[model samples]
Target: MRKNRLKLGLFIPPFHPLYENPTLCIERDLQITQFADEIGMSEIWFGEHHSGGYEIIMSPELMVAAAAERTKSIKLGTGVITLPYHNPLMTANRLCQLDHQTRGRLLFGGGPGLLTADAHMLGLDARESRDKLDEGISVISRLLAGEWVTEKTSWYDLNDAHCHLLPYNGPGSLPIGVASAFSPSGGTLAAKYDTAMLCLAATSPDGYDALAGNWKIACDTAEKYGRTMNPAVLRCATDMHIAETRDEAMDQARKGFEVTQRYFANQTAHVANEGMDVTLEDLIERGEAVVGTPDDAVAQIRRLEEKVPDFGTLLLLDKNWATFENKKRSLEMMMRYVLPEINGDNVSRQKSFDWQGEHAEEYFKTFQQAAQRAFEKHAAQTEADK
Candidate 1:
């Protein structure tokens, strides 16, 4: 029963079928962002991908910039910027500019690129990329803080490098989150920097088991680094879709589940490795992918909180594992139903409904009398007008 403000948001890689037009896929993702804003979703995070046709958005910052113009209140974030892919100085400046463009609604997520192919094409090895991630984050953080850094490092050297344009929200308000995908690299960075942690694979059993341990690591790192770690700002993400009924949701999800599964398995092994019997049903059963009714979604989230208490946000992994209509409907149901249930907003409404039902006859008679009076008043008004 650990209670906290459960903010809703989407972590969209903006997946699409290989045969589909890339422009259309990007447009559809933008449309979803606008829709999410209209429905009071607090944030929308876009992923950075280079090689994959399914995850076609190569620049999450660009996508966020476009989404910024379309959305007013919803915060736009880089699902991650893949720090290894860009120059740290340039990243710091670009993100600073984005913070102003977005009117201070930017959450800068730092991570090493997930796809090995993406790194290899850019002439980076795993060791080099991880080192870059570490250095890149450090450099970006310093630049964001308006520090003039001069250093000769492994990858790139900067001579008194500093960002000309600082963040619109001042120095510290724009959040910096680190993405942890079944690894401690992100958690360590988050701790050392005193930033937010995004547990990208928290839905998996291994991920879930490591949740508390990772936070402990973060806490220890924070203590060693003389920084404060706020566990409440940590976000746990999971694949989720909701409908009017569990069977209906599963039916709708079955249409595109395998397509999504294949993409994840092929692209980054985010779902399951090949030749594994991890079906859509298996994911749902394991609390990895929740394709069910709003009630079921609520129950799953409660269970997650039970396992890891006091965690702040539950990020619903946005994907097209159903029809466009079904996907939209699922998000709508999540906002209208699941959110209220988890936040306890539905308790008073349910209580009021029960109270009314207990005195139904009396309430019906009173309503009938009130309607008669209204009708008679309307007739009298008509006569007076005549």
Candidate 2:
């Protein structure tokens, strides 16, 4: 078992139904960040999406800036800024600024954008996204290192471009992460840039199967670069919703799951065509989601640990499967019960309790002997007074 406690966090691609108010949806997201910070969650990430009505945040940097003020300790991340859609120089500058704004609490997450619709809106070929992301990270990494970058590409050209401000902790001090779904591209890029690997689909059957293979890819790629992949920075994300009981959790998440899945099915071809008919049982049986009690959540995480063995964090992929209150309750339950169990946080306490139980007779005998001694001393004292 990895002795180091696995950190807990949230990756809020933030699925909201079309019927909800957008303003309130964003506010709730910020509130969740604040609540997570108060409850000592390690971090929270916001996503960038332009075309997806369900995953609406548009600018994760803007969310980070807003969340930075509202939060104190939890690290804020661009769950990913779609690298193919933006100028590397501009993105680097914004990242540097956010690093300072968050007082070094910003995690820069970059990815080839997820949605083809988003790429289409920018008049970009979706096929070129991965290459563009690779190029973008390279340029951004160089610029952030305080190097004068004079690079040219079909999409962008930098003429002696340098960030006005380096990362708050100095160049290369800012933590970087790349999103990996089921492909080796993310692992390859992570090793190339020495960034953390964010296994965004770790709980899905395919993603789970790829865990060891992806780590191997990262390690092999890093060997080429003479750099070692750090398992301590590897983060795995999964869908989870927990309550006091499995039935209660299932009830809370059932309707929301339908809404979100239907949206995914419409926007994402890879999503199950069953749409609204997809049941919570279907997700659980497939190991695609954990919509049950905290014990169920612990089991899901342990299952992941079995595959990867050593990962830095378990990030709950935030969903609106439950109401805001229920969602908050789920997070609370995770911190209060699920995390402690997985990390063995209460092992010593349990041992101490069992030891006391085992020695109950001996302890009672000692107490009785002390009481007898006190009574004898009092009787003698009374006689002396008389």
Among the numbered candidates, top TM-score falls to: 2
Q: Which candidate leads in lDDT?
A: 2
**CA error at residue 269 for candidate 2, angstroms:** 1.8
**What's model 2's TM-score?**
0.97
What alpha-carbon RMSD in Å does predicted model 2 have with respect to the real structure?
1.4
Off by over 4 Å in 2: none
Q: lDDT per model, in order?
A: 0.84, 0.90
lDDT of 2 by residue, 1-386 (tens): 46577999999997888999999999999999999999999999999988878888999999999999998899999999999989999999999999999999999999998889998888889999999989998888888888899989999988989987999999978888998999899999999999999999998888999988999999999999999987878999999999888889988989888888877778545564666666779889999999888888988988988877768899999988899899999999999998888888899999999999999999999999999999999999999999
- Over 200-289, each residue of candidate 1 has an lDDT whose tens digit, in order, gives 888788898787788778888998988877767788898888888888888888858777666777754554454334688888777777
